[model samples]
Target chain A: MTAPVDDPATDERLLSAFLSGDTQAFEVLVLRYRSPLYNLLLRSVRDPQTASDLLQEVFLRVIKRADKFHGSAKFSTWIFTIARNLTIDHARRMQHRRHRSLDVPLGAKEGDAPSANGTLVDRVVGTDVVGERAVDSQEIQRRVAAAVELLPTEQREVFLMRQLQGLAFQDIADVVGVPVNTVKSRMRYALERLQAALADFEDHLEGTR
Target chain B: MSTCEQHQDNLLEFILDELPSAERRALSDHLSECEVCPAVAQRLRRGLALAATLPIEEPPASDTKAIMRAARERSGDASTSVTASTSMLPFAMTGRWGRVRAFLVRPQVVMATVMLLAVAFGAWYVPRRAELGQPPAATMTQPLVVASSGVSAPEEAPAGPDGGEDSAAGGAAQPAPAPPDTAARLERGLQAYGRSDYVAAIDELNAVVSAPDADEVAWTSAMHHLARSYQQNGDCASATRRYEQLFRRSPSYNRSNQAMLEAGTCYRTLGNEARARELLEVAAQDPATREAAQTELQLLGEPPRARRPARQPASRSGAPTAPTPSQRPRHSDAPY
Candidate 1:
């Protein structure tokens, strides 16, 4: 019986087809994951081109190592794990380069780099916007995006994986290599940070409601 | 814990709609009566809504196509039965002339033609060589020396500028033959790299790379290994520096393409996408490295280069063949 190429029931089915020599099945998988994975990577790297490249690399790894994938975990979890590892490597390299150039000691957090202005959170979120004229929804959105950018990498990743990608806390924990409780706590702290940063906007939104 | 503190734990889950039905109902009931709970829930809901506004971007269409093409190519290489079936279908369905054309273009046919031509040329040339009383072509050239292990054999060392003799014989200030100790260090470094002892490899390889008495070949090999050791040890900053140095100092090195591809990857890992693209683009031009470099370039958001239409049989075209058993370079082998 021919496997219908149009719609595969599960990602694992597509991957199995690919292993058995169906290239079209692999294409279906790529199309399915393209947007969510791209957005996840974009949020992680904060650059469109880097995110795009990473998206391709994730699939490339899948293509090369599809056979190594066991059915013990989901195909999504396996692919996401690859993406997370690549991102971690990218962050490490960037951190190493930055530390060398700035003469910052290795293992120093990015937030700890001495700056005249303040920490990223302080600079981005400490502004007094509550007394200003009411902001449109677009403005609120822009501020929210900026605040997300300012989050510590760990919290930002958890927030995006949960809020944007809609990954379960358990799946996120798997991808992050943390206990589920740690993942939940990170998500909580992330929300708390976002709430503080957007307190003024929240007020504006409440008044409008 | 205070009642409010206990409720705060479930507030986030409730807002996220992740709380089970029963727990969600309880939290919803508490929110209606608690003074602080409703405001906290509203704030979180607003935060989640705003964060969701960040756009979900679609990647360029070319990226999807490139990924699929790579998968097909890899699959073709991996499964001979797939290749046979797919390749034969086109031939069978084509018209008579198309079938003839396909047969002519087949790699086996092309290789056979090349072999017949070579034999015809050899028959014409061999008697002339005997008439001239010349030494056989194989004997006229230097014997090919293959290194045993990662250590470069003495015979395989490149000829120095003053010819392959020791620079001391020419009274030049050029780098001399590696001292016994330096040679030993080089051997140890390579052995360490082979065994994945990157920390010890770095220590040993660094000494050989820095030794004044190490010859050009030894120094170059040592530098390559040192860069690899740094990479394996996750010190990419040092690795990038060394790889770049290799490019500048030894541009004509046989493994320069491989070095360029790796350096580009290191730059990418270091978050320098522009420089990574620059190096990968150059490496993509070399046949030996084209596939790997193109893959990296694709990952860096560079469009895949247009593939050549017909596959040229590498052996017939004199392209570099796969490494021989004696010349097996592990993925981490030194460039030398």
Candidate 2:
């Protein structure tokens, strides 16, 4: 578990330290959050290369707007809001470049087994199940990614942050500018859809395998 | 069978791993009793773990490096220029001068400049006496508002008194007797304040403050009321100075703490945040002033509530003491 601050709570302590010329605090914040934030961006843009460019934009916007972080909201909430805006901007740019629809299903093929639509268990099971297990892993990652990509934008954001990245419901609510209960409800529906997509696997785990 | 909605909803936090230990334990207890919740929880948890493994490819290293480098460069450039300017000008006097220049460039400057000119003109225009070879202005009014004793009988009024205009009105009309009920007059003054007529309230309160028979209670109340009237009228600088005077003159007044609080509020509202914060620090330290000071401090978002006064260092040496937000009294959020 991430430990709460062991040091005294100084208002603007981190920002003030950064402003007074210590850059390492900025780096610590970056390293602490970069992975989850980058993943969120990657899923939104659906292009790793574009997500990388957009991640830089998000951070650039953060530094540019750091002075505006008045402690009114949690720092991470503010950071994610910036990331959210950057993703929207990236999506718009891609749209202008002839991305006909923002919500294109991923890895949907004619012969893809209905029961083979991947889910989270497959991802975990696929991880340890190697070479011979490789095809199942790819299939699961694809179906799971497709199901997630098909989520309405708002629900998708809440789902990614809550279920995938493990953000607290309150934190996701703050990031998405929704009520906490709304975040919980969105996660519930997202989980329900994933469960249904993988119902066969659930039966198989209970039955033969 | 328990509804999937109810089962999944209860497992939501566990699916996300945000469930506190107590809640997790409770959930475990419930799971043994209710089969549906555990099944849903297990399914959701497995799904989430897989979702977590979804390749969140590292945003390219170049972009990360570029953004961080740009941020550092921008921060460095700004800091260097500031440091250079401050070092070259000693004590950041250059910064102050720049602010003053900006202030003087506004339209209000002309009005202020003219008011200064008028005051300068009055200094010479309202002279005590004309020179021996020169004539005074054809008509001169007597020095205004000198001592006026209680309503004098007409017989005591001097007839055709010297060149003073106010000297004649005094003679013609036996001045009316000073109002008998000073408390009634004070009542009227309080009513004026309720009506938002600060000027009338202040005039009446000033009369009460200066009354020859003004008692300690009346005098102190009148002064506090007058200062509050000035503050309500948006004359913060005047109100603050008046409260400062009141504090020194009547430190033992029953309402001394109230005056101190008003002075601090005036400074805070007038954009003299440093002075306001200093006064708040003093107020926060004094038990008499603590509650009001706490309220104001909370409004300013000074968190962790009150901190204990730190023990003074034995040797006056250590890593630079991190200034307590209260001690430093930074009103960074205060508008200029």
Candidate 3:
């Protein structure tokens, strides 16, 4: 998406402006990051509403202590670090409460509520929805999302940063609080597991068409 | 480690196009012939490409606006500690990026942004207004000295330094030539107001304001000084009306925000707390007029709130159910 800001100020500069009492700088920061932040959170939380709340919480914290910005890590890494922690925290809380079986399947909400495992694929390729190609494309997307959601949390986080967020391994390591080598190992494991999980659907790749 | 084992760890980097040139060439050569590594690389590429296809959901649009609104309300009191309840900040925060969390969620950014937009809008609106209100060059610099008791308020007196020490010990110390027409009428009114002659100043400013051929700049200048005349004359009702008109029609008018602040103060003094709160709240939003507005509000004490209607609890049966009030001191290790 095209950013709304002009002058192309660095995040640090924009944040500095926020600290010194330029409120618009902070708005620009919010507009710039809202989408990506939402996606990152939503991709993990698997619920749009919950993800938006997490995104708000992330920036809410940012807004509170706006006077100071960490000088070391880049802003994206720093923000994603916060997001990662919140998502993990929420996930752990839900997990402990549910104590559901692992076989509950990927993409299932952690409640007695109806399973989303079937809804994801069905919503994508439901009957009378669209063309065959569109259905296949949506099918692949649903399948990929499920595969991603199924990865181990550490591996999933590394993969999300690398593929979805486009963070370099070093930066991902910084966000996840791991050594660079550990991050690389996790990314490799993530890819390997995703490939293994979705191997049956590889022939359905949409981009090649 | 075998040739494949050594290059195995490099595959993720290679797929990312992040491998150094030498390592890339080595990986490429090895992958070209190594059966296991070649398939591994293909799967890696396919897996990443598949992951890329997962849709980027557009978050609900209201999310940011809601957060910004919350930020503004939470941060409105600058003196309140922002991080007073950050029990929700994640991680140990022992070192790297520890300090960044505070700023990440502060409301001041949005507050500052609102101020910036207001200033920008004011900046854009003022020149347009000036273009709209253009008058002859001769009449533009006409000044009206505020009755400041010998303290010069240049903002009230745009006139060139004319002549004479302020005659009164407590008069505003501004001098200007005695001229005729709109400028003269405005000057006469100002002189009267400065001399504490409210009745004559009101009559003179009223005639000048009602004049058919008044210059646009002179009209604005007249209305502004007329409000001052009314305020000094202790006619706060008329003063507030004039100030509110100027505030709505031409917020860029000199001391327009000041007018609002003053109007709010006047209304508050006259036992109209609601109007005072409204005007003071708006004035407090502007950086230039913030201190004045906030000071007035502090003086006004807490604004009265409307009483909420009593809520009846819903019961499936036709019996009345008393609602439980959860009002209590909250203790938690999490930030809301």
Best by lDDT: 1
lDDT of 2 by residue, A82-171 (tens): 777666545534433443222122244434444443333333223333334334445556656655654445556777776445567888
* Candidate No. with top TM-score: 3
| Candidate numbers, best DockQ first, in rank order | 1, 3, 2
How do the predictions measure up, each by TM-score? 0.47, 0.43, 0.48
Ranking by TM-score: 3, 1, 2
Per-residue lDDT tens digits for candidate 3, residues B75-164, read: 555654343234222221425464665555468976887889999998987787678675534234433323221222232231111112
- Between candidates 2 and 3, the one scoring higher on lDDT is 3
Native A-B contact fraction in model 2: 0.23
lDDT of 2 by residue, B63-127 (tens): 55665565575467775432332222112233688677557646699789989999988777657
- The 10 consecutive residues of candidate 3 chain B with the worst lDDT sum are B320-329
Q: Which residue window of length 10 is worst by lDDT in model 1 chain A?
A: A98-107
- Could you give candidate 1's per-residue lDDT for residues A1-209 as a string of tens digits? 11123473688988988988889888888877777787778866766777877788788778767887777777876777777666755654453243221122223455565645433334335445565665666666556765766554566677877765577899887776557865776676566656656766666766766
Clashes of 1: 0
* Candidate 3 vs. true structure, TM-score: 0.48
Global lDDT of each candidate: 0.61, 0.52, 0.59
Give the per-prediction TM-score of chain B. 0.41, 0.34, 0.37
Model 3: fnat (fraction of native contacts): 0.29
